[model samples]
Target chain A: MMIDFSLYVITNRDLSRNKTIIEVVEEVIQGGATIIQIREKNLPTRIFFENAQTIGKITKKAGIPLIINDRLDIALAVDANGVHLGDEDLPLKYARKVAPHLIIGYSAGSICEARKAEEDGADYLGVGSVFSTKTKIDAGEAIGAKKLEEIKRAVSIPVVAIGGITLVNLPEVIQSGVDGVAVVSSIIGAESPFQATKKFRFTIDYLRKGKIC
Target chain B: MMIDFSLYVITNRDLSRNKTIIEVVEEVIQGGATIIQIREKNLPTRIFFENAQTIGKITKKAGIPLIINDRLDIALAVDANGVHLGDEDLPLKYARKVAPHLIIGYSAGSICEARKAEEDGADYLGVGSVFSTKTKIDAGEAIGAKKLEEIKRAVSIPVVAIGGITLVNLPEVIQSGVDGVAVVSSIIGAESPFQATKKFRFTIDYLRKGKIC
Candidate 1:
């Protein structure tokens, strides 16, 4: 796991800046998004490619790499930092052939997938629904903190806990051994996303430091 | 299962017309492509949307519906006939909610996933890697035709054999009791894709008619 969790932000064109998805991404980066994954599953390829291109430029500047979800073509098109693939998406090895050094992330809902992603040369793992979420209707059952700990202990890579994570639940999840939290509606849907990110970052920093920030 | 298994056309973008993908699809439709899934995972949402729009137009003209692969975004974006998702993608239940009337296809590598897919309101199931291929790396151990039979027996829905299925061994696949066959490279990478699809259609017709093409 080359990535250590600080702030894993999943971009949403819907909520956030009410501006271009790219601007919202910039704000998140400004608010301390250490890692960003552009998951615009609905936008046209051109839109995704353009957004990725814009975001890729900024992330490169911010030293944050943008990972596209399930779209190797878009990832390659923009020369983005990397791509995130689910078990059913283009196999990581195949994606690797196309996007060589890009940091490839895999969706690991189970111990089996996490292990496979590691063996397959995944740079990091997005393990989740640390709790059930409406972020994406298809998310697997919340794996619970214990399972997160088990996976965290098992894999040598960084584990980013996703799905329904909020400040209220931050301490428990962090204690469960996750390197960082991947958020959706909580921040993107918030009236003040920057503030929300600050709170999340503050909480994570406090817990990690064993002292309130 | 809403899908007919006599002959199935794996959808392609450029293959819609005057190409091998289209030719194979049309041939299979003529011989009998009971269901057609337009699986172009490469294009952006808009491109996929546009291609699916063209495919939807054509398939509707031919009375055949098209299924988008792992893209509820493009499927809904294009208002295509249906959407197919892999196990690691979104869950069928959620996709069903979003596209109630559209056909929902699920890809499963194990009996457990197939069973889960059925419980999740899946319209059909894609079971595979019956042989290894470059399409999906980290493919499960080749389950072979016999295993397909077992899967067919296990699931009440129609089972479409996928992953590395080609003209060379479709007979054994149908003989194993699969309702349909799904191929990626066989059509996309072929020199004469139109003829290849025609040959597959003829072979399927032969199986149904109790003779070889």
Candidate 2:
């Protein structure tokens, strides 16, 4: 399925200024985040599933799609809109088979991976570590905007740029032709996640419309 | 799906005497392990998926069921025979929905959980820590064979007893009316996994036939 999200805010509870994931997601929806990806790297499976259920309610009420990161089982259990898989996560083909109606997203750091993901039935591609950051220790070195542009051009599926994505670097990332941006620290780590997400939403809208923010 | 297996072996590479999981599985199969459940608690998701693929090939060639522990995604990705989920793992209802044809096993410690699992479409029940041991830190207190028999009577699905099950206690476990036994340290951590598995298999067979071994 083709995905239509623009500003995809990934949840990181540790960086959400002491708010629970549910609270962060509510604020994100209020700030106009088109979609929310629940990315808990260090939670027990049952807790994660419960959290997903709670967050699913908030997102559903706000008319926002909820995407679960790295856990298709949890995503399916909660009937979230989709699941996003990284290089080390579940393979796209099997995920597609397990949940044909659920949107499946694959992470791609190169044009080769991007094309393969699209061919393998990924609804969208999460590309990058476009700029280096401390959010994910294993996010690898930054790929920069040039590589992002090449990968974007290589696939027909939507490409979402991620990692170290802040307001300062978002314009160049948008110019790389990605369909959306997946942010962590820029939104979740901000003093006010709502304000930060609003700024991101406005900037992406301006950039997509070919106007300077 | 009705599961018909006697000796269910769970892989623990750490206790396999320096052998790779594949090698341990080979030995277990040689000793007549009716089914294998790949339980990699520490491997990365991609590596776990790869290991499942390798074990899947072995189980497929041997005409035995391969049950991936706690990872339905990897199980489906490799076309395993089933997936075994614990209390903290994926919910059985969603797993049943995800893979209707595959055997789904649920871990239940009480009669309420067992009946609920069967009602929720679990093909079989893995009931245990039948005896407490150091193998699984979170296995909880030993439920004893009395509890096992109670749980067994509570559900119509096949019950596979797990946790600290050794040949010495195997007879009592069988007398509790379980359909099979799931062993970790008793087989994998043995000096000869094949011999250990063989003895357990033979004992189980003899016990089932109502004969003293």
Worst 10 residues of 1 chain B by lDDT: B13-22
Q: What is the DockQ of candidate 1?
A: 0.03
lDDT tens digits, residues B1-213, model 2? Answer: 245569999998888898999999999999999999988886777789889999999988988889998878788778898988877877788778878888899988888888998999998988878998888723567899999999998888899998889989989999999899998998999989999999999999999998863
Model 1: per-residue Cα lDDT over B102-198, one tens digit each:
7888888788888998999998888887877767522466888888888889999988888778878888888888888887677655665556667
Q: lDDT tens digits, residues A1-213, model 2? A: 235568999998778888888888888789989988999886777788889999999888877899999888888878899998877887788778878888988888888888998999998988888999889823567999999999899889888998898899989999888889999988998888899999999999889898864
The Cα error of candidate 1 at residue A130, in Å, is 0.5
C-alpha TM-scores of all predictions: 0.54, 0.94
Chain B alone, model 2: TM-score? 0.95
TM-score of chain A of 1: 0.92
- Per-candidate DockQ vs. reference: 0.03, 0.63
